[model samples]
Target: MSSRTYPAWFHRVRSLVQDRKARGQAFRYNDDELPTRPQDYDEDLSERPNDSGDSDQSSILSDISGNASSEKARYYAMKEQRNERKKQLRDRRTGQGSNQSDDEWSEETEVQKELEIEEEEIRPIKEALTEAQQSPEENSAPLKKLGGRLFRLWSTDHVKYCTFETAPKRYIEFYDPKEFRGFKTYPDGKIDGHIYMVSDDMCEIDNFTPPKNPSLNFVRLDGNGVCHCFEVQFFDNHHLTLKMPKDLVFHRQAISPPSEAPEVFTYYGICEKYSDKLYRAKQRKEAQGK
Candidate 1:
């Protein structure tokens, strides 16, 4: 068969189409081996400054990450140290085995231990001193023994003189040894009308204060039938005396006691004006203008 001749334009168009088809088939079949699009020089020039900026950002991020990791490690290490210290303290307090070193017990702790030991040592001494410091008034009475019924007060056999600095009175007891009827003159110049018996040997008086000597309580009935109380004490069994209250004061004596009778005035005491016969006598004399 004879081939027909195409026009030059048609042959050109056909050749162009066939070339395009071949190129498309080559691109589809061999996509992996295809040449990359050529880079634009202008675009590369424009992105050059961004590359440097990205590098700087990456370096800063790496540095921050490294610092954060280091800080985290330090924090965990400090936490472990704190926990160990707490465990040591708990073990010591609970009497458990402790891992603490000897340096943990400081000088202040040693001083505190020494002070505690000293206090314990002195405790008995402090108690003894406290007992010794108590007042003498709390002690028991002394042994008072006068050969059974040594002497008596206000007996007619004995002449007694009151040498109190305030009052110089005299007393004589009118006693009937058989009848037991008797009366005695008091330091205040009043007569004691009560007929009371005094044993031979004086006994210790109790429930009274100012515990210097053996003392007793004496009750007197005056002429008015009123009872008054007096405290009586004796310097010795031979010398019967009176004991006065601490608050009572006496006048000065005109004459001192003789050397031989140094304690003769010890029986004297401050006189009560209301209970004194001499004072009443003086008052009556004044009122009567005598």
Candidate 2:
């Protein structure tokens, strides 16, 4: 045994001091002095106290979540209100609920109602019409009351002048059968008639009769409050002449198909009668059948 006894503690202390000196002399980094790895520091980090900044961030996140939830709730609430209003409007229109009422009818609805009423009354179209439907009589009392008289007007009858260039025009003047339906004139110069004359100028003529002698008749007011007159001369039952301030003549031959022919134009004629209530006139010899 050596005279000097080495204790276990003495060896440990000596080694520690030697190790420190060796590190300092060699410029070596100690394990504690070196940067710690993030993985290695994880446990220690967990043990550390929380900071105010971290708590603040957590609170902000919570606040943002709360605000988002509140906004969603408000959005849904407004959507529900809009849906309810739409339901009420729909219900009212369908008459599903008496409690719900409409503010007013739209202008289009009012106009439709008016149109329906007019169609019902005027019946411009009727179902299942037939040729056998009573034809207007030559001398119906209604026709007489309306100042209607049948007449034939001819410009020329000679075959020598039967060409359109040389031949005179012809027309059979009479009232429309529909004219017997009804008529009314308003103060505003508005008129409603089953057989209304709508031309360059509007007027309603009940009748036209020639004076005993050729003379001008009194001026009369049309539905538009416009003035009009007629001149007439009776040559005989077979012949006559007529002049109207306005062209209101409707041709008998043209009545059924109706005419695209000039309904309004200056008309003068020398006409002959086939009979008292009917007449014959020729535009061209080619139109002899009419």
Candidate 3:
């Protein structure tokens, strides 16, 4: 039997189908081989500039040969265009585009503005703290006026010493002898201690025993049985303020002892007895103002 002649297109299609079958068989038998199908092949010959002629195969071959260099140049140009398009897509996806950069700048500006506003708000507080820490001379000016006066503790609590005298280089504290009831006292009912000027605003009162009760004492003593230093907060002829190490402040007022004072009067008792008198005086003053 004689083999029949077939058209060129028919031969080409037959060859492609056979090639696909061979690849599929090889992929099945060997895991490393890849299967390729006829449809997966890119064969759009009509789009090729050299394949536009339909006269004969020789004419198509001659056209391809004549435009080989131009075709290579065109291929390279298309590849570069594709690469540029891919780079632009990547920039947009990663927030590196022009609009995204402007957004980032705006966010940074907002943060900086917020920090400036916070700093401005705290400026006054910082200045006030600086003045309070640096102006010890202003606080010490009142210390000189503390000497040669009888000052009563402003509190109503009956402490061991309710009144004190600030003598030259000495501090003399004493309680009312009659107010002790049964408690014993020294012959003079006074305890003397040396006072040393430590700094512009600080002083040390040494060689004095604090009250046995912790609450009755004005300041805590140090580990060496010495008194803790005092910070003179404010002072005048009639009033004195001292700050303790533990940040406690105590006030004292100058008082004139009465000629006929009660024999058994305590600090609290005196305040209680005179409270009504103080209230009546205030009421009278308010009425006079009206």
Best by TM-score: 2
TM-score of each: 0.16, 0.21, 0.19
User: Clashing residue pairs in candidate 2, if any?
Assistant: none
Best by lDDT: 3
Tell me the tens digit of each residue's lDDT in model 3 across 184-203: 45344233232211111223
User: Model 2: per-residue lDDT, tens digit, 164-237?
Assistant: 21111233344444554456323321222112121112233434332333222222323222334444443233
Off by over 4 Å in 1: 1-169, 172-177, 180-226, 243-266, 269-290
Model 3 misplaced stretches (Cα beyond 4 Å) = 1-174, 187-237, 247-280
What's the lDDT of the predicted structure labeled candidate 1?
A: 0.30
lDDT string for model 1 (1-290, tens) is: 01122123223333433443342322322323221111101112222222321223233433433444533443334334333444444455677755455234443453443344334423433343344345342352542432222222221111121122110122212222233224322332122222112211112122122224333323221211322233444332223333222111111223333334322222222112212444458669988995
- Show how many residue pairs clash in every candidate, following the order shown: 2, 0, 0
Model 2 lowest lDDT segment of ten: 158-167
Number of the candidate with higher TM-score, 2 or 3: 2
